[model samples]
Each structure stands twice: as structure tokens, then as C-alpha cells.
Target: MRQWNFRYEDGEWLASTVPPADDNLTAAVETLVVPFGENLQAVESYLESWGRMERENGFNYSLSTPGAVARRVSKESVEICDLYDQFEDTRIPEAEFISLLRALSTAMRRGT
Candidate 1:
């Protein structure tokens, strides 16, 4: 099975086969590993939780299209764009997106 490691690099998200070395970083960073598979339900659940968090925080956003891209729609902008922009890949695979959402959901659930 193939796995991809995603990390925040230079204010953007980058996916690569090899994990970044500790000596190459300045601060602590979390990485998500995505395994290839079908996980539609997981993706949906993550999106729902994500939307809920945004709504609770008073930000207007929407998950749209077959690609499932989440975008901010409100005039009052937030840091979501910067977060999304970190995803360097033009087309993010469903499994990868689900992994990201799962991490976010877990963080939210833990109240961290």
C-alpha cells in the first residue's frame, strides 16, 4: 500500500513520500498519513463536524462540488483560506481529505 505524508511547509501544505526531518524545522508540526482507500462516510462526517465548528465560530463556509472543496462565503473572512491554501496539491484525494478532517475533528472533540 502507498502512503503519503503531509506537512506544513513555508506556510503551505505539502504532500511527499518522505517525512520531513526534524533538523529541517523550526517549530513542532503535526503530520497526517493517508492510506489509499474508499472512505466516503468518513469524509462526510468530517465535513459535517468541520462545518459545525465554523458555524459555532461565526464563520460562514460551505463544502461544495463533486471535489468536496470547502470555501468561505461570508464577507467577514477568517483564516480558513490560509489553512486551505496549505494544501499544495490541486486535487486532494478523498482519503487524504478525510484524514485531514479526522485530525481536525479529533482536535475539536478533545476541546483543544
Candidate 2:
């Protein structure tokens, strides 16, 4: 399973899949970062793009933002609640959620 984390720092939103090893870790090994000022617009654009791409590719997944975690559910409406229960202490943000979708889209396009 792939896990992601996001943080707003130095006027930018940084995203990564690697979890911090300890409380002392400051900088994250980011996969991508969009300037903080562009967050709202970027998120909107990415969501629309993802929707169109999914339609064109006949993808059947749906994204759900409930509380802190972002969930990916299939047409059947199944979720990984069991997995989420394991990490009840963690809190994720909407930006990281959208970033995860973007990452998935990119990976799919690359056929990886």
C-alpha cells in the first residue's frame, strides 16, 4: 500500500509518500510542491483533469474526503476502513489527498 503525507511550509504545499521517521524530521522528501498561493486553483484544476481522464479511460474509482483521510472507493463503494483503522492517529489534508490522485493519474499514464 502507498501512503502519502502533505504539509504547508515556506509558502508552498509539499507532498510525499514517505512517512517521517521521528518528530525531529523537518523537511519532507517531496514528490511535488505547488506554490501556496496557487493551491486552491491547482486543486480545482487537478480535480477536473482527473475527472476527465477517468471518464476517457473508463476508470471507475471515486475519491472521498472524510475527516482527514482521503479515500479511494470503487464502484462497489468498498473502502479500506480496516487499513485506516490502523492509523487512527494520523491526520491528512485535502491537498495531500488531491496530490495522491494526481500521482495515481501520472503513474497510470506512465503504465507503471
Candidate 3:
């Protein structure tokens, strides 16, 4: 199974399958950084916006800086694709994704 966890390290919160070894931004199957302050709120808002029926049904959510795009594959799953590198793409359950975000938010608060 894909391991999902988050940690507060070096003034940033990192959510990844495995915590990165160093600050060099090593490759991982899936990862996202939850920056402190207002950015954290933005991340939470993005999470909350998922799985909504009001919007267009097949819309893709793009994370520009990370070069990743996400789309809901089903009610329970989401697919993430790396625009720069196809090897990093993955599909995971929406619940797991939300859990990761929630953990990152909690970690950010604790780290602050």
C-alpha cells in the first residue's frame, strides 16, 4: 500500500509517501508541501473543493508549480499526473488524499 504521512521539517510541512531524506527535493511517488500561514488555508480550501457535484463533472485541478494535475476518477479515487515526468504519476483514493491534507494541516499547526 502507498504510505501517506506528513511532517514539519525546516520551517515547512511535507506530505509524502515517505518523508524526504534531505532538503534537496528528492523524487517521490507523491508529495506536496503545505507552507505555513495563508498558504495553508489555500491548501485546505483546495482540498475542500474536491468531490463537489456543483462544478463541471470532469474538471482537472492543476498544481502549476509542481507540474501536477489531478482529476476525480470516481467518487472514491483521484488520479495525479506529473506534467514534467510521467514516472511520478499515481492514482489514490480520495479519502487517503484528504487524510494527507488534514495531517499536513495538523502538522503545520503543531510546527508553528
Q: Write the per-residue lDDT of candidate 3 for residues 1-112, one digit (tens) a residue.
A: 3445566566555455653332222232233442233366766676666635315555444432253556566666766656655346667676766666576666556654
- TM-score ranking, high to low: 3, 2, 1
lDDT of 3 at 17: 62
Better of 2 and 3 by lDDT: 3
lDDT of 2 by residue, 18-108 (tens): 6543321112212222322334545556578556755764534433333222233433222222222333332234354455656644543
Residue 112, model 2, lDDT: 38
Candidate 2 at residue 29, lDDT? Answer: 18
Q: What C-alpha RMSD separates each model from the true structure?
A: 12.5, 12.6, 5.1
- Cα miss at 9, model 1 (Å)? 17
Model 2 residue 79 distance off true place after TM-score fit, in angstroms:
24
> Candidate 1's residue-wise lDDT over 1-112, tens digit each?
1243444345433443334333212111122212111344554565776568675755455444332234444433322212233332232333444455554344334433
Per-prediction TM-score? 0.29, 0.35, 0.61
TM-score of model number 3: 0.61
Question: Considering every candidate listed, which one attains the maximal TM-score?
Answer: 3
